[model samples]
Target: MIEKCSGNTLKEEFEDVFDDVLIDIGPLSVYYPPGCINRQVSEQSRKKKILRNNYLIKRNQLVLVRGASGSGKSTLLSLIKGIIPDSIFAVIEGRFQFVEPSANVFCVFQNPYSQLVCPTVKEDLVFTMENRGFSQRKMAERLTQFSNFFNLFHLLENKTSKISGGECQKIVLASSLAADPTVLLLDEPTAFLDKDARDEFYAYLAKLKGKYTIIIVDHHQEQILSLADQVIDLDVGIDIDLGKKREHTLVSENWGMIRGAIQENYCICIDKLSFSYAKDAKTQSNFCLKDLNLNIESGKIVTILGQNGSGKSTLLKLISGVLRPTAGNIVIKQGCHPLAPKEYCRHICYLMQNPESHFLFDSIAEEIEFNYRKRGDRSGNISEIFGYYFNVDIDVDVDLSRSPLLLSEGEKRRLTFLMAVLEEKGIMLYDEPTFGQDDASCKKIVTLMKKLREHNRLQIIITHDEKMAYSISDIVYRLCQGRLIDEC
Candidate 1:
């Protein structure tokens, strides 16, 4: 339908450019800045297999592109969004044309933080909308429209960096909708959302299918596949089998399998805990968490699920000492010596929702060596261990010397995750551990969890992936209105 439409017709409807452009980035040689990468795999001397096909995204259809980590799903979006030929960072070597492309093509990247450019939510929207020449009155109208439309009015005053990753993803999406692009490209939109949020957002998108030409790239395929008008499996030229569809089961149905840890092996206790991002506000409605209590056991996998803004991340932060509790006690039973949250961080490894937040070094080589050096292992066996787990073609010993920031979202997650495992922290804390992971990668993580259980290590995962929680978790907790319910 879209291929038949003239550019004039689309511009008339969307008030933005909708050119019939075929993205051809082949023989497509791209080079990153010198000294940027140690391996330089993405930017090789010859044309590597990247967006090498002359693909035309059908108009007015929801096309989903699926592939494993580092597979050009994002780069394809970048090409369509015109980030390739326009940027100074990458040198392109092919004809990438956007025919009669007078209108803008906005993309909500996989990493929501990268797309958000302003300090606060409203400021970010205004900044995005104003770029398309929206007047003050029109921008204000859009700010209120999307914020309230997406149930984000309360967050208008919230700082972009201060909010949780899932909230940031919503804000970025809202900003994209407000921009009203002729082509709306979403890269893993549901990566940060909990199950409820993912369902709700997809339902909303299904309603907007006709209004916007949607192109989504996602690894989680259940609801997304059903919603797509057409599916494009990038790895192969056909729809990838996402396993059989299963009926949704009630979270309460598995209560018998959920068992609590014994007192003697108790890992941590949250006693009358409460936290408020704004402590001295004029009203009492601003509190995020209020007087919650819970207990974690060693050798058990605990999964926490909740809607967006349900204080799930807040609980993890409080336990990890990223944020101090307003009033309450987080006591850790560290080998018979009770320790405060701050003191207990040394014994626990907390993976942030955004993997980039967990990195200390710029290069992957330095990052890996830091772990091995701390243990005084100078042997070449470190690379062997890396190959065994990650199975990447690159020499595990080589630095790739690329900045951790330059790595793809999935690579960053794997790198930080790999380091944490090698460190052998007593307790592991994961916030959205399944983000940027495909089915195989998720299976690897499940296997890793089994290994952790054999050693009696505690794992507390704050996520929305129900299947993952059901697969490995011994205890499941659902967060609602600043409280944790032992659903299992």
Candidate 2:
């Protein structure tokens, strides 16, 4: 049976489970520049924004922090966990507690790619334990246990970069578990997994529950609600409370007519496309995708699904005019197409899988407004447009002189998406738009997609979330071994 405990009681019990283990934080604040740019000028002018006040977390209790995309949820987690420098844009107003001696903490980021520092899976696991001075025997034993637990035994010797995103996620968790930390924090752990992989991953977590004080920052509530002991809602600033069951109504409406029906013109057409990246020096013949022919209709939602390295991203790049096809020609309707790839960016926006790469401005506000002004359209104010689309307030007076790189991962992604959407581009390409978001943020993204479709814009999203793909897509396509297979 599930037992509900108060925050104070939970904290006490947690400290008792792992003696001297506690996480204490006084008031903390984080700041970002005025625009979402990564340059030094923007970074220097970014101002601190208060994130948490008087926040304290004890051991054993599972804490789930929910908020919008840029709501500083991950920033708070980073501050509490000591991931970034205190002297940076973040300022701490109070002290924090973590047990000395036996206290160990591990954090798994939302993007598994960023967490991987080693070349091979087995080496990655061993590296962490080695750093902690674990005996060789103990490290091997722990590796075996973790590999068995996550069904990653086959991936032990595989190149970490060659593994699927889902498998990489499991590897990150395994590496973290091998550290034997008393406190484990997972940031959007299931963002990259397929349905089956997600189920299996969570099942493993269920078995390991109560053994570690787990704090998960995630957006997939349906999968996590029953498992979470306590949920912290961060809708407003610094107000934490218990979670309640929330029911969401699934609204069904034809999104095709949002832009007043699709025109007969072909927006993007690809014929016999192919691409490959060398796996190793010995195998110069390896290819990722082959013979991909697809057509993108005007003002419709199209989704592409595939396991990692199935060329979904490669296909997206080709469509967005980022990558040149080695064998095929991509033709756009003559009158409606941009003259070149650089110019094509004006008409087609591609939200890369890595959000940090797209940030070219300093502050979140400036990032949003820059795209608006760049489009040469004075149709709407940046604050009002993003506020209405995302259902979140954006204070115009807030500083727009900070660095975008200083924001949390989720914030960077949201800002990237907002910039793309506000650009009013005709064709928007989203590569895993829900990568590191929580449920609320995911819903807001869906809302934004619907709004764009209402304006008769074309959207193509590459994702593994079946629920999201089905919910927002008008058509779905699957890619396997670099081939496009239609799933009508």
Candidate 3:
């Protein structure tokens, strides 16, 4: 049975009798200093309160926390992981009692790459158990069981860097399970996974129900709600709206439409193009894109959909001149003349799937100002551009002094997108652009893409959102193995 205990006397009483109560948190409140809270602040000037009083967690309970981006769901997870006030600077007002040892709690971060420490998949999976002093036989047994469960046997010997984002997340999850933590904290675990892989992951969570205390922070409410025993709305500080559907309504000025400057027709021709990564000694699937042929024109939004590591990202890299083709050719033309490799970056811009990869400056203001000055666009103001596209005011909603690294995953994604738009390139490549965004932010992205299309800019999108793919795409291609098959 779950019991809520408040005050010093009740907490003591629960400690003596309620063995099931794994955590007893009394009138707790957490506050953060302005500009990302990088260090502890003595003065109480402009500090924002992230979490407030009376939060309780019971043993083996499945709790789901929901909120918008930058609403402190991740902050709460860090507190539960015992990282706040020590690893991350935060002001704590009250105490939280953990009945279980801190070692029994494991957190899987929102970004999978953050926790992937080992070089290869196999090593990463076993790294936790090795540090925990598990016997060799015991490690072997757990490895075999989880590898089979997650279908990660094929990727066992592959380097973590070579695998797709979704594969990296799966390996991280497997690594956490192998550690056998009693309390599992997951932050958007399925953010990078495709539909089939995501459904399979949901099934695994169902099977794992009641075995461990699982606290999940995610935007996929419909899929995860069935697994949650109790839900918390962090924004409201109460449990409500267990069955409310998320509404996405974004209205922004059509910046591209306002410009009304249509460029000369550009075309990308891929003729029997093929590319592959260097083969690993024991890897089963050495991902490659092979003998693909396509004709892409300006003023069209083309999307490619496939499973993880199906060479969707490889195609973008090759087209954007980041990687040369192993065989065949890709030619970008204005009217009829082909552009040289040296001129590729002038016309094409690539937004990587990982938002952090785009950051080069410490603060948001610096990052934006640097890119804005480099672009040398005298036509528009930076604040005006941000408002038109992202609907974010430069001075009001965002703290310009904060580090971009301190922003939430969704926030980072939006910032990267804004930087890309600032480049004013004719051709844009986006990889999983909607990965971390909430429904409302996702709508904003769609509106922006549509606006770009109206400006006659060619866009090549790599995504797994089937609904989104079908909605905005003029053409959709599905990649299998190394081959592209037209879906429409």
Q: Report lDDT per candidate.
A: 0.69, 0.67, 0.77
Give Cα distance to truth, residue 4, candidate 2, Å: 26
Tens digits of per-residue lDDT, candidate 1, 1-488, equal 01221233323343344354323222232444343334454433222234334344555677787876655678768767877646534555443445436656888888766677798888986777888988888888888888887778888898888877788899889888888777788999988887777887898888888777788988878878888876655442121122222111111122221123223343788898878888684343666777788887688898998887798888888888888878788888876778765677667888888777777886776787687557554456545544444444343222345577765677677667767776666788998887887776677667776677656678899888989998899989889887778877
List ranges where model 1 is wrong by over 4 Å.
Answer: 1-46, 52-54, 88-97, 118-120, 126-128, 134-145, 157-162, 236-266, 278-287, 340-343, 376-400
Model 3, residue 127: what's the lDDT?
A: 89
Q: What is the lDDT of residue 91 in candidate 1?
A: 55
How good is model 3 by TM-score?
0.84
Ranking by lDDT: 3, 1, 2
The CA lDDT at 97 in model 1 is: 46
- The predicted structure with the larger TM-score, 2 or 3, is 3
Clash counts per candidate, in order, are 3, 25, 0
Question: What is the TM-score (0 to 1) of candidate 2?
Answer: 0.75
RMSD of 1: 8.2
Query: Lowest lDDT 10-mer window, candidate 1?
Result: 245-254
lDDT of 2 by residue, 1-488 (tens): 11122234334555556453466544443444334334554435433333334445556767777765555566666765665434334333334445442557778877787678899999987776777788989998999998898788888889987887778888888888898878888888888876667888788777777778888887777778778776655433321211222111111122221323334333777788766655342332465767777777666799998875567888888877778766667776534653565677657788988888987665666776776677464667766654554444333222344567765576567768767755656788899887776565677778778777766677899998878888988889888766778887
